[model samples]
Target: MTFTGVVPKRRLGPGGPEVPVFALGSWNTWDRMAPPERRALMGRAVEVGAAFFDVAYYNMGPHAEASRTDLLFGETLRELGLARTDYQLCGKLWLWEYPEAGFAEQMRVSLDRIGAGRGGPESFETVVVGDFMGEIDIAQVVRDVQAEIDRGSFASWGVNNWPAEALQLALDTAAAERLTPPSFAQLKYGLVRRSMAEGEFYGGWCADGTLALQASDSFEGGILVGKLAPARKIGADVGGIRERIVAAYPEVERVATDFGATPAQLGLAFCLANPATANVLFGASRVAQLDDNLGAIGVLERVGPDAIRAATAGLWLDRDVRADGVWAP
Candidate 1:
């Protein structure tokens, strides 16, 4: 399928300007494969108009063991001769360490992987603090993020997987301190999952001029892909994700049939269909997988109001009311 003409773009947030509808997710792809495989996938994603790539310092494993993934991502982009400005790069701070200094080092390590060392120019325009996981001190995290910005390490910063209240608190603290508030927030949203997008998180951020970047928008572990059947044992590789999905959405099969689109495509489109979602993050393991997902941008554009309503109805298992809530059945 040749994607002719330009892929449509949407604003990063109100008054934040526009970016491509689909963004490439590097978490599983970078961790599960070797450098060459990851590089090829990155190139293919770029060809299909997946101009944004999401990376994080701890994407590989616990601690910094997987830092190489980010390095390989940059190397591949450079090898493809794509100008840094031609693509948008978004990465996160692992935040495993607390206090401002440890957090600062985490950002520094992330920048180094993306080729933005002390004197080098930054290839990334956006940096996010990961998960928050309801554990970190929101105020301190915000302060550390601002320190990086002050040093010219990043242009913008935001939160990921944080609850609506936590996000508001961070924004409020930044206001009191006169620091730069986050410009984006990353959350999970898909055909079966709408609460985060439709609930307080979306409303709060939208009102605050912050963009919502939807990660795992496809409902990671392939629940939205319809590959794993209820009562069946998932392969050892994806067992953890599979178990979570089966537990949460026992009726996934019934819901999958209603969408007409494959689980993967529907999941991707669900996020794209929302006007509030700035971009949908897709995880592809191979070049072919990347190509297949890029087609979703077209599928999303074709989705009308009825399709969205039908897909959301009876598809979601649960909804998170709090900003830092986790939705595992």
Candidate 2:
């Protein structure tokens, strides 16, 4: 289906930039696929208006030394001859250490790799602190991010994989200091894992319109697609989160079948059905997968919210499935 005119747009936050509701995420696929193949996929997405892209600095696969996805994105955009304004690009600086001295350098490296030209912060629409795993020095990180924004690296900033309380703290700190507060929060939110969606941070954001939630891992690492592991085993051996999600596959499939949709379609639809979901960031390893996910945009209206919730009623584990959480491998 052509998304040129049908896909919807939502503001990044209350007053943030408006982005397409359905955005493409580059994780294991962009660097793994050949340049031309990945280029074709990006082209297809852009042509269909699902061009808002989510990329990170850490996902170049196991063998890579540095990020290749950013470079590949630049190559594809250049090959397609798309102008800077044609699409929106979001990048994440992955830092595990409390204070990485090379924050600005890392931003420069990613920006240069993308080769989108030096229009200051115009090179990136949004950049985020990617997946901080340990105790974070809130004020220090906020100051560092603000310096980058002052230096014109990105227009806005957000956080990924941080606890809901921590996210709220950062937001509160930003308000107290009168600095640029995080405009978004990207965490694992889907039909199978409803902990974050049900948490205080999400609730506060919804109430005050302070932070936008970017829902990731909507497929529960593919278990929500109804593609069970060999022998139909559902446990840590398959995937920590998969085990939790696999248990609900039968019911998810039945509901999807009733609506003439595949389990994958229903999975994506479930993410979109969330009113708090600003964007559902998903990864695709193939052109077919990308196209299939794009079809989810049309499911929201057809299936409606009640049916989507009914279809996924018993799926929520009431536990956070984020990496290193109770479901981590």
Clashing pairs in 1: 162-323, 163-323, 163-324, 164-323, 224-263
Q: Using TM-score, give the best candidate's number.
A: 2
Residue by residue across 1-329, what tens digits does model 1's lDDT show? 64554656776653233667777766545666776887777766666566787876654224344446666666666666776666787767755445543656776677677666433337456766765443668887788778887876666776665666677788899899988787766666665455565666565565455665554545544655654552332112211233555555545445434645555555666677666677777766777666656666666667764676565666654343343434222
lDDT of 2 by residue, 1-329 (tens): 63445457777775456887777776654776787788788877777777898865553222145657666767777777777677888877765644653578767767777773633224567876855556667777787888888887777887776666666677788889977888877767777776665565564675477777777777765677865663321223213455556677888888888887777778778877777777888777667887777777677678798888886777877564343222232
Report the lDDT of model 1 for residue 86: 64
TM-score of 1: 0.80
> lDDT scores for all predictions?
0.61, 0.69
RMSD of 1: 4.6
Highest lDDT against the true fold, candidate: 2
Off by over 4 Å in 1: 14-17, 34-36, 59-67, 117-123, 133-137, 207-210, 229-244, 247-260, 320-329
Candidate 1 lDDT trough over 10 residues, lowest sum: 230-239
Q: Listing every candidate in turn, what is its Cα RMSD in Å to the true structure after a full C-alpha superposition?
A: 4.6, 4.0
